[model samples]
Target: MTLKIPLENSSFNLDVSGIAGFFGGEESFAAMSSVHLVRGRRWLGWYNSPGSYYVAKKYGVLAKSRVWDGLYPGVNVDPTTMLELDGKVGPRYVAAHSGTRMEKTGHLAYLLASHYSDLEVDQVIPGPSAKSEAHITIASLEEFKEFEGYPKLPADHLSPFDPIATVPIAFSVGASVMCAIFGDWYCFAMIILGVVCNGVSCFVIGSGVLKIKQPNPSPHSPPGDGVLFNAPGSRVILLKGSEKIISSITRGRFFLEYKSQSQYHDIGYSSVALTMQFLLQLFIVPQGQLFGQIMFLSSLGVSWIFNAYLASVDREDLQKRILMRVLLQKPTFRTVALPKWTSLVVFAAVYLQAKPEGTRGLLEQLIPNDTAVWRLVKSAVVEAVERNKDPSEVVAERNLDHLDNQERGLLEDMMKQASIGYNAGNDFKL
Candidate 1:
C-alpha cells in the first residue's frame, strides 16, 4: 500500500511496500527490522516497528502476546518471510495492521505539519479512486479541520517581551550610576549580585509568563471560563469543554505546566514582595547604611531560594503531564511573544557557567541539576559545545541534512510571516 501525503506545493508518496520487510507477524521480526530502517533517522526513530507492534496489538492484532517485548537491537531477518506475512495475513490481521500503520502515519504528518506547514491525512475510500489503489490523501489546512482532533492553524501572535535581555541592559545602566555615586567595592559587589538576581528572576518569570500565555485551559477553571490572551494583544480564544478545545488545551497545558508550573500565582506573590523590598532600599535608605544593604541582600537571597524551589517543583509537575500526554497521543502549541530577552539572559548565563569554564559558577551551583530549568541550561551548553567543534564533527554528530528547496521555502515563508506579525505588534506598542 502507498500513502500520498499532501504538502504545500506537492504531495509525498510514502512507499510502505518498500519497507514491508520491516513489519512481520512475529514481534522480534518487526522490532529489529524497523530499528535497522530508521537507525540514522533520529526524527523517525520513534516510529520503529516495535512501537507499531504495540499500536497494532491495541487494535486487536496478535492479542495473545501479553508480555511487552520492547524494541530490540537491529539484526538481519528473512525478508521473504516478512513479505509473506504482509501479503498473506488474514482479513482481521490485515485490517488491524492497516489501522495501526495509518495511525502512526497520522502522527508523523502532525509533527511535520506543526513545524513545516499545516497538513491532513485521509484514507482513500473506495469509489472512483478505488481503481487507483489504497492511499492516504493529504488535505489542506481547511480540509484537515473537518476531521476530528486536528487543531486550527496557530495564530501569528506576536512573541512576548524578553525581560532577560532588557534586564541586563537596565542593570548595566544602574551599575554605572552606583559606580558614579558610591565608588566602593561594596557598591560593585551589590551591582554584581543585583544583575545575577535579575537574570535568574527574569528566566523563571519569563517561563512562567509563557506558560500563562500558552493556549491551555486552566485546570482549576471550567471550560468557557478560561480565556487565552496571546502576546501583542491581538488574539484571544475563548475555550470551551468541547472535545476539540479541551483536547487541544489539555495537550498544550500538559506541556506548558511540565516545563514551567501549573499556575504562577504563588511565584507572582514572591516576586512582588521582592520587588517592593528592593524599591524601598533603593529610594529610602542611605547609600552607606549597612542595615539597608543587609536587608536587601537577605531578601535577594530568600527570593533566589524561593524561585529555585519553584523551578524544581515545576520540573516534577512536568513529568506527570508528559506521561499523560504520551498515553493520550496528543500535544498542543500556541504562538506568543518569543521572550527574546529571557532567552538571551538565560543563554548568557549558561554559556558563562558551562563545565570547564565556570566564569559564573555561582548560577550553576545555585540551580539544582534535577530541575527542568537546569536541563534547558545544560542543553544550551551542549549545543554551544557542539558548534565549537570541527564542522565535519558537528555535522556527523547531528546527522541532520539541509532542507530541500521546497522545505526551505516553506520554512522561510512561515518565519517571514511570524516576523511581520511581531514587528507589527511592536509598532502598535510603540
Candidate 2:
C-alpha cells in the first residue's frame, strides 16, 4: 500500500535514459496514475496481475480472436535510460510497460526479458529491499532492428500505448504516435455484458414478474420442479428433467424454451439496442473521456438488478418453502381433520433439523430477525463453550473476587442459563 509517486520528501528519484514507442494505452487501465512529478499524491502502481488470466481466459481478453496487450494503463514506462551531456541529452528508445508479476522479482521485469533480450544490463536500479517501493533505472539499451526482421505488431516493443491515456509522450524520450488494436472492449461490449449479467440475475428473482401463465397447458397440467435455462432463446438446461426431482427423467417437470416468431422479435430488438448503445459508447469514449468515465460508472447501477432469483433459493425463507415442498410431496394427511398443536411442532421440527449446507443462501432472505441462522450459530458457539467447561469453572472460581463485575456477571449468568438450556443437568446416577 506504500504508493510511491510524486509525494513530498520521496527518498529516491527513478530516471530512465532509453525509451520509445506508444504511450496512450498506458492511461486506459489505470486512469489517474501517471509519471508526472506532483508533490504529495498517493499513486496506485501495478502490483502483480498477469496478462495470461486477463488476456487468455475465454471470457476476458481471448473473447476476441486477436488482442493487443499494449493497451496500457497510465504511465508509459520507458524501458531504457538516458544521459544528459549535450543539447541532445535524453532517454534512448524502449518498449511499453507490460503488467507486473514476472518469473522471479515481482515488478514488470518480464517484458524486458521476453521482448528485449538484446539489451545488456549497464546498471539496474532495483526497488526498495526491505520496503515495498521499487525504482528501476536502465542505463542504455542496444536495439537490434533486424533482430528478426519486423514484428507482427508494428508499434514499438519498448513502450506500449495506453487506452484513455492515448496521447503520445513529449519529445524527451522520442516516443512515437500510438498504434493500438481496438477490438470489442471499446465501450459498447462491456455495457452489453454488464446489462446481461445484471438483467438475467434480476429476471430470475423478481416476484410477480415471472407469473406469466404457461402458454401450453392441459386442463390438469403436471406440476413442474426445478429451474429452466435457455441460451440465446434455445433451451440449454431444463431442471424439470433433473434426476433429483424425478427418479426417472421421464417424470421431470416439463418446460420448453423454444422461441416463437413473436418472442424472436423482442429478443432481436433488445439485442440490437444493446449493440447499438455499446457502439455509441465506443465511438464517444475516445473523444469524451469524462463521458466514457460516466458511462462506465452508470453501468454499475444495474449490476445487481437481474440476480434476484439466485437469492430466492439462497434465502432463509426458502427453508420454510423447502419444508413445505418436501412434506407436501407425500400426499397423505389421510382422514385426520383436526390437529392444531401437532402442526406447530411439525413446522418447528424443520427449523431444528434442517442441515446448513443443504440450504445455501439462508442468509440472503434473512433480515436479522429471530431467524434460524443466528439461533443456530449462537447455539453451536454456546454448546462448544459448555463442552469446554472453562467458563463455568472460571466464573465459579472467581465469583468471590469480582462477582459484581459486568463481564464476570455475564459469564456467570451464561453458565446458569446454559446449564438447563441444553438439558445437560446431571440426574440419573446409573
Candidate 3:
C-alpha cells in the first residue's frame, strides 16, 4: 500500500494504505494494482481483481497459496513453485520494477503473492513447516502472453486500453466535432440516440446482474444451499444465478441503476442546453447563435470534469454523492434537476419550431424505478444477517421464501424507508 517511487537519492513513499484498507473481504483473491506517477503531482491507479480459485486451478497454482481451497478441497495445486528466482530471501528481496507493461504487471502479481501467500499457507496447510517455507509465484512474460493467445475468453488478464471507459467519450467528442461543422440537428440527434442506447444498455445489463437464481429442488439440499464463495471460510456457496455473482463480473455494476438515472439527468441537461442554442438562433434579433453553440459544447466539457471528480472519489464520498442525488438534497439536487426540467420547456419550444418530438419523457416510461433490484439485494442481505446464513445460500434457498407473512411485511416496510426515492427527513440518517 505504501508505494515508494524512486527519486534521485531518497524514494518518495506515497501512503495509500488507507485506500488499500477500504477493500475488505473474508477471503483472499488474485489482485493486480498499478500506480502511475504523472508530473510528480497526479497519481493514477488501476486495480484488476480475479477470483483466487479460478486463477489457481487454471494455472496450477499451489494450494498453500489459495485460502479458498478449504471449500473445494478436490482442486489440485502443485506443491512445487512454477519457477524460482535467484534471490528469494525476504530482507533483500526487492521486486524488479520497470517501465514495461509486462514487468509492471508481473511485479503486481508478485507482490500479491508475497503478501497473501503467507496467510493461505498458514490457513490451508495447517502445520509449522508449511509456514516456515513461505513461498510465492511469479509468472514469466512468455507465460503471461500465453493468456492473451488463449482461444477462450474470461481469461485472467489486463489490457492498456479499456473500451468501456473510452467508447462513450470518443462518441461524445466525435459527435460534438461533427455538430460544430454541421448544425444544431447533429447535437440534437446525439443526445437523443445517447439517451435511447444508454437506457436500453442499463436495463438489459441491470436485469442480468441483479437477477437471483434459486437452487433446484432437492431433498438433501437444506435451506440456503448453494456453491461456496469468498469470506468467513463457510461451506455455504452462492446459487448459480445469484446477484452476488455480479461481484465476480465487476464491482462497477452494483449501483448501475443509480448511474443510469444520473445519465438520464445528464441527457436532460444537455437537451436544455441545445434548446437554448436553438432559441438564440430563432428569437433574438442579431443574436449570437455561434456563441450559444460554443456555450452548449462547453457544458459537455464541464460534465466531463464532474465525471473526473467522481472517478477520483473514494467510497464514502461516492455514497454521499449518491445520497444527495437520490434523496434530492438541497442545492445539489436543486441545481442539477432544475436545468434538466428546463428541457421540458425546450421540448415545447421545439414542437413550435417543427422539430420532431424529443426524448423528454422516455426515461420515466423506460425505468419507472429500480425498486425491484433494491428489494432483491436488501432481502438477501437481511436474511443472511438475521439467520446467520451465507448470502449465496440465501439466494439458492429461494430468496427469503422462509419468511412468514408478518416478517415479510416488516421487511417491506424497511425497504420502503431504505429505497432510493424515499424522502430522508430529519429523523432519517444515511
Query: Which is the leading candidate under TM-score?
Result: 1
What lDDT tens digits, residue by residue, belong to model 2 across residues 201-237? Answer: 1121111010001123233433222211111111111
Q: Give per-residue CA lDDT, model 1, range 213-245, as digits (tens).
A: 124434443222122221212122222233333
Candidate 2 lands at a TM-score of: 0.20
Displacement of residue 176 (Cα, Å) in model 3 is: 13
TM-score (all chains, Cα) for each model? 0.21, 0.20, 0.19
Question: Per-residue lDDT for 1-430 in model 3, tens only?
Answer: 5333123133333222122111221111111101110111111111111121232222222222233234234544221111111112211111111101111112112222233232322112122122322111111111011122222221122123333334334545554544444444533343333323322322222221111111233333222111111111111111112122211111111121223232233323322332333333233312223332333344334333433443343422322232222211211101001011112222111211211111112212211334554345345434443444443455556766766787677555434322211111111211
Candidate 1 lDDT for residue 35: 18
- Candidate 2: count of backbone clashes, pairs at least 3 residues apart or interchain: 43
Runs in model 3 deviating more than 4 A are 1-209, 222-293, 306-430
C-alpha lDDT values of all predictions:
0.27, 0.22, 0.26
- Which candidate has the top score in lDDT? 1
Q: What is the lDDT of candidate 2?
A: 0.22
Worst 10 residues of 2 by lDDT: 78-87
Local lDDT at 48 for model 1: 11
TM-score, model 3 to reference: 0.19
- Range of the 10 consecutive residues with the lowest summed lDDT in candidate 1: 90-99
